[model samples]
Target: MDSSIITIFLPIALAIVMAGLGLELTPNDFKRVSKHPKAVLLALFCQLVILTSIAFVICKVLTLPPLLAVGLMLLAASPGGPTANLFSYLYKGDIALNITLTAVNSIIAAFTLPLIVNFAIQHFMNDGQHVGLQFSKVIQVFLIIIIPVCLGMLVRYFRPELADKLNKPVRIFAVVFLIIIIIGAVAKERSNIMQYIGDVGAATVLFCICSLVIGYFVPRLFGISSTQARACAFEIGIHNSTLAMTIALTVMASTTIAMPAAVYSIFMYIFAAIFGTLLNRYAPSVQPSIEQAPN
Candidate 1:
């Protein structure tokens, strides 16, 4: 319950995860963003527009507390990470596009995430209470997400084989690390579990569905292929709740604020899997490869 404990645990966990992220990536991953501007822009648009709007509605309609509401907004603001790439590969979505989107989104989120969270706190908690983003917390994000990533990129630059070899173990660590964070968060907030179960659970599921729907529709309107559309849908729909939890715990030290994201982490995985199955079954066939570069 101590603020210092939460602050200390959250950043260390996030930093480890970021280091795992770095171990798996190459400088080429970041470079891919420039090569696929359309896909990148499309994902960004969905994140800012569709996801944010849905989050606002959920927070308001569900009457989410200020901290939880802000947490949801933070989660929505984050981009797909390595997990999205793995999911995309599993679901036969474009792996390259997933990587490019993840790389770009992570970089953009440093600025966008704080802005979004701060706005949500102010908007939802119009009452006298004010919750602002601390400069120190944002700096922690920079250190956790950005700095480790740069180091990993350097590893790839100087030691390609070493980077490649670390990938599997790092990925394994990601899974374990994520599980611990979720479990610990749940344990810490065990008393509030019932209070949050219905509202946070239902809203998280709805948000995930909306994310997938928007993910598919926007790209389809832009004439992107069904496969890429599916990829974007999952990427944009299922946020990196880990990032949200990290920020909540490290910066705000409020378990209440971290609830939505913790709930979301569970919901998105289940919902996205179901959505992927339905999309693959019911969606129209991909016309022979169009060969257009992903924007």
Candidate 2:
């Protein structure tokens, strides 16, 4: 596996997609923060605790290879992408909270994701397979993720109509690129997929459930409405597997490591849809206050 492919191409592709995302984003998106601060905080908290705990348990119990374990943890640590907002809309969640959460999560992810990934690598790979985090590689991550996103925001600030126009085309590209990447990954790894599938499947499923559960309920406990909780849960539950796979293949040069994220990318949607349906059935409708009610 070539480090350059993962480190360079993957980030560039994602950066372009994220820039498109930023272009569509507005100051109003960030301003929604005050409207649901508690919900956002709860969702973030649940995401951190649940995913980290699941990663630790999976590492200890499954006795996974160091690279694979760290990759799973990295996927866990990565935050929601714009697709989460779309999903929230489809699932009848609070889109406003979803957008706010996505924006905040992406910003925090630039810094926190690296720290969490490095920590996981250090902890799980303590045996000797450690591929140390080179500062140069971190710079690559910042360039790939952070710089383009900020630039997109600047574009949105300066040229709102242009930014809005690019949104649909960018989203189309995102879907196409994602499909190509997943299929290519699966086909490329066909030889090892059978061997590793059983090994990683159970842990991945468990981790996904944990994320969904914590992401949804924790916000409710904090007094956020169920709609907002649903948004947070789904947002927190979805991991940017593309980013994880890119890091694993490019920087880590470990196909074995990339396998978890590859597997996850396919499974998440199915599971999330099912989970969302179940929640919709069981949770009560959140009625808007009479004063704020629609006419």
Candidate 3:
């Protein structure tokens, strides 16, 4: 990618996409955490603790190249994308739960993303301290997520009709942007793209499978309803790779560390769809949806 594109344009484009996510959120989405404490807490634990630890073990066991390992870890650290709600709706999952999770996770990620990436750098990359998350970079990560999201929420709260109008287009743009980011990152590493995929592909695929499986079953084991469990599966399975890639290219300034997210984006939708199919087939016997999807 061109330096201007990566440095100047990427963040702006990503913020627009993120603001689109914000358009769908409201203050109530955050407050819903209290209403469904068990489900919400379980999902967050899987995202921050279980999935992250699994990613680390995969990196260590695979002995991926340092930057590649960090890339994988970054993907794991990322929160679920807005697409999760769409998939949740399609699969008869609790779209309201998905939206609530997205609302909360987006906020939590501001703090956790930098910490996880810094750890990956320190553990995987030897000169981690030099390229690590500094105070300014952490603030960049914070604002990049927080500001646009809050702005979008304000739009939703204040100008709801306009927010509703923006929602579909922005969501479309977000999907398109994900494709562009993957292509740009891959083109940047054209010569090594094949090797990079070979190294990280299995790890990404395994991570996706684990994410979908654990996302569903862990909730099931806790006796959460199947509808809600399906929501958990998709939310945990589909990551916001665009955010990961944006942080990598602009904030971390390393396309090498962006490779895992790039490759994972390719497999993510495929696996997510397949997992959705299986969930649909063996869905809960008598799950009734009382929650409506967000606009």
Candidate 4:
């Protein structure tokens, strides 16, 4: 809510989180994309196109308030996080593909996020109601999203031991910061928190289901293996809500625009676990290829 917090602390917190994500990545993760081109492309199409379209339709059909609609769009645009890899690992999905998707998605999101958020701002927010991510602000968003990630990758490249040492603590901090951001967003709008939930709850839930379904089924339809489909499901279904919330609050300067991500964060893990269980129970078995376990 405060100017300093939005302009200073929030970006710094998000940079730390992105850096932590980078600590887990390496050149190999990106290169792994070459091994499964169809799966990777299908997942990206689902994430970049289908999922955002679903969010838009849900918002339009649900008739969400402007800020809330934008918030949901922002959440849709965010990349997958490390948690997706963990979910894939837990449920016999291809964790390597998850890692690869996450790596590629994070890179793609740095550009697409700004474009999507800017479009949402223009379309959803009323004239003079909120600032859009125009040229300068878009540049700021790019820096906030990408620069720290590159720096962290550099750290991993140069000081492997330090990167390893900082990894867990930074991840812990990322989780803690996400909790605090959710609380702050809720507290800042406490009077309307319940109403916001009521407005966005069904939309977020349906969007999550649609994401998981599309992420999985679209690739399967294209002849992707079940394990890879599972990876796509989790990667597309579990968004980096921390990134969404940070951009909403710090870049957009609107708590109302952070509410969807806060609410979605609450729903994602529960829904992802359920979706994973159903897949595991019903889908035909394909023996998982032994890969390096997710750290």
How do all the candidates rank in terms of lDDT, highest first?
3, 4, 1, 2
What is the Cα-based lDDT of residue 11 in candidate 4? 93
lDDT of 2 by residue, 1-295 (tens): 3456555676677778888767766777777666545666777777666677787788779987777788788788777867777778777788777777777877777777778878887787766575755788776666667777788888899988888888889889877767766666667778878777787887788778877888887766766677777788789888877767766666666777778887788788888898888987999647452123221
Worst 10 residues of 3 by lDDT: 286-295
For candidate 2, the clash count comes to 3
TM-score of 3: 0.96
Regions more than 4 Å wrong, model 4 = 284-295
- Pairs that collide in candidate 4 are none
Q: All candidates: CA RMSD in angstroms?
A: 2.3, 3.0, 2.5, 2.7
TM-score per prediction, in order, is 0.91, 0.90, 0.96, 0.94
Error of 3 at 175 (Å): 1.4
Colliding pairs, model 2: 3-250, 6-250, 215-233
Number of the predicted model whose lDDT against the real structure is largest: 3
Cα-based RMSD of candidate 4: 2.7
Model 2 TM: 0.90
Ten consecutive residues with minimal summed lDDT in candidate 4?
286-295
Task: Give the per-residue lDDT digits (tens) of candidate 1, residues 1-295.
Answer: 5566566766776776776666666667677666666766887899887789888988888887777788778778877757777777667677666766677777788778878877887787767875667788667666677887777777777888988887788788777766777787888889878788765888888888898889878988998777777778777876888777777767776777778888888878888888878877888545322235444
Q: Measured by C-alpha RMSD in angstroms, how accurate is candidate 1?
A: 2.3
